[model samples]
Target chain A: MVNWIGLYTLTSREVGRFFSVYRQTVIPGLISSVLYILIFGFTLEQRISEIQGVSYTMFIMPGLIMMNTLTNASSNTSSSMLQMKLLQQLPDLLTAPLSGIEIALAYIIGGAVRGMVNGILVLLVGVLLIDLPVHDIGGTLLFLFLVSWAFSSMGLVMGQIAESWDQLAMIQNFFLTPLSFLGGVFYSIKMLPNWAQSLSYFNPIYYMINGIRYTILEKSDSSVMTSLWMAVLLTILFTSLAILLMKSGKRIKQ
Target chain B: MPELAIQIKDLKKSYQDVFALKGVNVDIPKGEFFGLLGPNGAGKTTTINILTGLVFKDSGNCLVFGKDTVSNYRFTRSKIGIAAQELSVDWFFSIENLLFFQAGYYGINRIDAKQKIDSLLKRLGLNKKKNSKLRQLSGGMKRRFQIAKALVHDPDILILDEPTAGVDVELRHELWNYLRELHNNGKTILLTTHYIEEAELLCDNVSIIDEGKILKKGSPKSLTEDLGKSGITVQLTQESIDKKLPMLDLDYSIEDSRIHFSVKNPELVIPKIIQELTSKNIAIHSIKTETSSLEDVFLSLTGKSINE
Candidate 1:
């Protein structure tokens, strides 16, 4: 039986946790988004012109949105879970009537909420400052939700695996950040050398960036369906891994 | 017969190189105030942890109300509320939020949960500090909050692991009174404590565990009668100090003008001792009898103090 009340309470607590620290969780993403818009969009637009028919400023919006979504979603769960573990407060959840799947879903929903909120806020910033025309509002929202959910699950998996803040930072710095930067966030794959483009095909985050760009700009280098499928696959992969780890009592349980 | 709230059979658990529980067995019936009496590393907390699904047992079975704890964890967990030994809390949240969340975890909705939480806060004397974060509260207040959290869910079984370990005397007595009231209201409480007096005062049945093994189990009175020895000390006059004592078969000692006797029954031996001393022309100055306590029972069973 599902514990609906427990699940709701846990999810709300997670959301409220990050929301309470909005200065640290929410504003940083917005401030950085504005900075990127000013530095890369306006300053470089004069020299760079356009990437794929849209203006240089317009082309980077989707990538910026996805970047914000990915970072916030993943960080929310990873930090929350890690802090709870380190503080030995996880017994509150473990000893509760909640099952492994219910716990995982609550955490994912919390992360996804943060992810979606930050992603949409960045998109709104784009719309407000650049007068950026959104191609499809519904599709953009759907894509944001899916990507946020996927990355949130991935964050939970990371949280389960990483033992300390140093370990978590290592995973983010060496793996997440590098791949995110290399995943065509700032430029199109067409601009990269052929070798780099081939490597980009191997990067799952590349598909996420590609999907969001297509959703917001109505232009893409790859098929949007493949991007959607990749998002679905990542979501299943990380969510299943997270639930399995929780059930097995890997790191969170002893 | 009322079903046993807790039943364990040859339950075993080991952590790496050390064994925390080695073939331990215990049964506690419904509405009974049971205590797992032990020293620091006696596996009392480990047993509670396993029962609450926080730790896994290496072998044997543990059941809550005839339901296997591991197999029926959801039902078992929902029926059991535990206050852990350590102060495990999220300092960021207020006491009210913590209790509210705990109630919700047991399937209680906000409306019903609020009433219960408010009553709990008032009962625990924490209503004034409901909005205070854990770090802001004193150690005694935090301890009270922990109990409040455990009771918030209103589980069928309340497991308190050293609930008053670090609290002051005033709070401890208040907690004892509150616990007695809870027991009177028919809440089956399983308490684990190293404080022998606490166990003797509160528990109807106690299992004295040491080094992960149960040394003895019974009511405090029965255990003292069976395993403990009473002591009788008689202070004699200076003139009788040099007199030869009677040939008593029991273990005894003489110190200056005092003669001490260690016997199973102080009541039965006191008259014989008085007659024997009187016949010998020994004058008695004063007499004192000490009843065997649970501490004495624990000492006689384990060859050491429970506090050690």
Candidate 2:
């Protein structure tokens, strides 16, 4: 049988590592989310007024939450792995009785926790600033959990393949940032033309944002069912890719 | 039979087009202080990496405590502690925090991990710096911390890759003394170093590898004795002694006021060499006698110096 005690200890260490660096991982993201809310919600509210049926502030709250969650989750795993690698402390983990699954799970879950913390912090801040209401607390929590898990796995994969600090930054700059922005973080698909809206349907982040929006504001650009299924599918896809990369140990083993 | 802590058979590894290990074989019995001796660019680090499961091999097999390293990695790995060649501790973490995290990685509870961490830091002379961040510690202290971290798990085998590379002589001796104590306590140690004298003093058995191949493998005494029968050195008061008359029946070179020579037997040839030199009225200042060392054997075998 696998050692649950060992898994828990490792997972705790991973979580603690990120928590210790809250300034870089958590606080900055929270501050940025608040800034985005103030600037986009109030400034743009005068021009656009409302998105779908909800106020612009409420419409963008879910997007902001998703953006913070995904970025935090990815940064948590990537930074942790890179630090372990650079410090040469990764050998300690490799020499342990823990399997690749255990290692991957520890990192992914650590990222998820950080993501959730930042997401909740941002949401709480949003409530204070804009009076946002939760239409479906259960669905919102579920979407937050799934989206965080998916991005965290992606971060782990990125960490393993990255050989230098520059490579790690490249993943964030080139792939993650673009995906988050295009994932409908700032604007709803309903605001787009028919063709652009159809294209947004393929963006996984769009589903996560819309799903979260449906839960929090009860007004989404897409159906709740479609968003739920897309979130689940993306989670499975990203998790499998992460696991496969970790198992191969291609760039990591050296 | 004593249990073999590590066994390798025809192990081979390659990186892209460069082969790192070529059909290398070795057996390390439990509780022995073994040294993997070689100069830079040799396969010493590669061998350690393979043993620790940080790198994969192209072919051959390896077993740790009789468990296959490839198939039974988790179990075997749990019994091994590796202090990598590079200083690999998180610079952002405090010394105490690093140890606690390492202990946790091995599944130790917080209560038990605290005890182990305290004892290790004390033994390593790092208790005062427990709260110091890794980046703030000196190089020697960082190296010692790495060793302390490795030992937190209390594995049966301890692999130290050049643990004393950048440390001063005193700290190096302290480190060696600590390693000796660990060996005395029945821990199987696989050490790699460029210092031949260090290997000669601490290792019970050694393997010299070069260019991804084992050049020689045996106990230090056996390998030294097998290289050549004996050696002799004659110190002269003047460097002009060689210009006065040609020395006979021996090949010698004057290096730093000393004339050194190698022979099958120093006792039988020493008297003749002395008489031959004296016949020309060559005045001698001092003389010394010795046997071949691992350095000599390595140079003769690999056609390259250990420090090369």
Candidate 3:
């Protein structure tokens, strides 16, 4: 019970820490998503009309939301942990009565909240600019929450292993950005060739994006069951790895 | 029962191939201000890190408040607070916010935290800078704020790793007074310092360590008094004192215009030396007597200067 209270306070501090800089954390993503909608959804509408019976604008909205969710989630956890490390404030947390599990959950939850906020903001912008229709709002929300949770845990792992600002930037540049861009953000899998479609199936972001697309557009190239199962697997795998890293006091502690 | 606040036996730690602490043994009793004195790279930081659970030892046992550090880490850590040697705080956070956040980490409620924060801020002279961003404060103010942050949780034991480094004399004195007050309130403190005078004044007991080992451990007075060897100096107008003051039963040497002697009792030997010099009709320009100090004891025990 006491551990839960510690976790709650820690999570609140982590969340509040980022929100205090909301202009940098939340507003830019909203503006970026609006820009994507204007340039790619409207400007390129003439080039590609519809994908799987849904308008191109509506089809790309879920991908954009997932992109924002995963990026924000991962960035929130990784950057918070890295900042604590750089400032040497992590010792305060480490010396507290909280356990490693509590610490891990606090960071992951903070990431999830930021990711969800960014995703919702992107969704609201999509609705305003492109009139995106919601097919299954419940499923869409569920998928967004799960993806946020998964990526936030991944971010915590990255933050632990990263030793410097350059190393942190390298993870985002070399891994996260590429995975996000290639997760079928602007195009459907049917539009790609056989080999490309096969390759897209291997990217975990593909499942996240397509699963969310299934809920928001009612039209998905990937199977919903497969996507859901893949997301759950990724969440479990990433969360377990993050917890293990924290428990072992990997690069973060000593 | 008088509790043992900290105990370590055969503590060892290494980073990669470089050994930081090797076979260290120490015990600090409750309600005492203990000093760990060593030069840079002498493993003082490593010992504190291990006690704080920021670093794992390669081999050893460390107990805090009667609980094993490794097995009962959470309980052990909850009783201790540390102010690291480095000045590390979030530049974005105001002093008040940083204190509140640190209090929150220890599961202190906001209502209680605010009360504690206000008192700590005032005590540390940080009340004026409570709302100031950490980066905006001067170096000395930031250092004081760190001490305030460490005290917010109100742990039973406080460990300060070179807390007064880079602080000016006035602020250092202010900090010493604050720490002394904390000690008077029955808090056990473990301090690591480079300033020998600071240790002599603040610590109730001290240990001198070098090359990852303890060279001496005792009260500052006892440590200095135990090195009772004294030195005497005499000056003459002539450079021929080397021949005048021949090798006697006492240890003596001549350098330039001065003659130097080392004896167990300066009072018993100084009169005899003066008589010999007078009988020889040597003009004594000046005479001085000196006894061993803590600095000399440190050098003799560590085989190296403290500032080295």
Candidate 4:
């Protein structure tokens, strides 16, 4: 009744699409994460020495992992959807007897898979780079998955809104990229002024970064409980929006 | 009288203040090679899109195999395979991979899908290019691949929206032959094309649509017959041809050293005209018969050529 086979095909297609261009999709994120570890984790950590009783390398490791994970997840869905729309391939899936919810779930789940893979890869890279500890592996994985699902769903919404490659690039370059970097990836929010610290609470990526940081190093500038709730809320929020847009055929129907 | 494969009743859809389908009604019986002929902006593509769930209709009902398009959207879609005018397959995957994935979407298993895809590739002459990426394919190859994608699921109805838009003459003929074979094997087909000749040759029943409404509907032969008569022209070396040929009870006109006769049946009328001209001491060079074609019927109904 659910057309499970169709759902599997779409998910496989979406996932295989990213995998087809591993040089662009998977390798870039891995290389960036490794570089961040080498330059900042190795060099900058020497200056900062320690933040909240952990080395700065360990402090930034979770943030780097979360950053690359979410970025890859978001890029996986947004860039793929935008390409399909421009190339006129979206109609193939649309006509494939797949329900709107099934289509959205396949794409979102595909993004989440990419996100989780890159996150785990970065985590492994950090373990090798600085011998980063795993204080709570289960919690880290669950949070990584939730963040991936949320960002991927957000990417779907972005893809629906964008009409061309230029518009897609603007969303990624101006919004997603800047938000991830400024979401306290490099430094803890505790170092910011009180006003800036208050503002950091609004950046959803902040909760993700701190949440993973709490899992790996058992250190945080935000409450783990609050971060968990924020991740769930964002996941629900973005997934619902994606489904609604897809079902209504918003901005996509001819 | 027959089972309806596709039934549209007052289907309406308007986009950007332009009505793409204004109360369109058509019933495609099972196993009929139906043609929906229309010029550009004639809503043929829109009709296919709505049936496939790419576009939502503004009003009215579209049913495929007794399943309402909205209420049973997935079931309706699973029954129809559409080869759209625009190339819509993903460039990311190879031809074989794309077909395999497409088959899987229709719930086909890997082994069955692989066999079906292989058979399609061989039948479509795409075996050599199976491994090639879509971007690496020629325009003709891309068209062939589009057809293959649509057939991967083996749907009950195949909707071809201008399947041979820019294909070469030889390939177009081959494609028509393949489509005819499919129709003979009990596959329902709905074709839309600008090439009236394609429709003339391949369609069992056709509906000419213009401005989002049906202007004419009948078999190509029947439609041509409804025009009542064909034209016959004789080129004469000597032209004293200002005479109405009273022998055949028809009117004759002359232009460019040729005498034109409006005949009800050229086969029966040409010889009589030849006899009458010879008796009148007219030198006849060549005689030509221009039978009324679907083009003529289209012109009479729509007041414009198919290409226009």
| Candidate number that wins on DockQ, 3 or 4 | 4
Poorest 10 consecutive residues by lDDT, candidate 3 chain B: B239-248
DockQ of 3: 0.58
Candidate 1 residue A82 C-alpha distance from true site, Å = 1.3
Which lDDT values do the candidates have, in the order given? 0.89, 0.85, 0.86, 0.87
Q: What is the interface RMSD of each candidate, in Å?
A: 1.1, 1.9, 1.5, 1.5
Can you give the lDDT of residue B69 in candidate 1? 88
TM-score of chain B of 1: 0.88
* Per-residue C-alpha lDDT of model 2 across residues B1-308, encoded as one tens digit per residue: 88999998899999999998988888999999999999987899988888778888899998999999889987788788888779865645688987877777777777988887899999999999999988888989988998998899898999999888878999999999999999999999999998998899999999998988988889997888788446789888775465565547677766767778877556677888788777877878877887667998899898878998
Model 1 per-residue lDDT tens digits across residues B141-243: 8888888888888888999999899889999999999999989999999999989889989999999898888888999878987988788999999899988
Deviating ranges (above 4 Å) for candidate 2: B233-287
Chain B in candidate 2 has what TM-score? 0.84
Give the TM-score (vs. native) of candidate 2: 0.90
Ranking by lDDT: 1, 4, 3, 2
Q: Model 3, B1-308: lDDT tens per residue? A: 56899998899988888888888988999999999998888899989888888898899999997899888887888789888899886756688987887787777877888888999888777898889988888999988888887888899999999999999999999899989999999999999987888898999999888878887899887787676456898878664454555446777777889878886556678888888887776778888888665678788786678898
User: What ranges in model 1 sit over 4 Å off?
Assistant: B238-257, B265-282
**Where's the lowest-lDDT run of ten residues in candidate 1 chain B?**
B84-93
lDDT of 2 at B183: 98
Worst-scoring 10-residue span by lDDT in model 2 chain A: A1-10
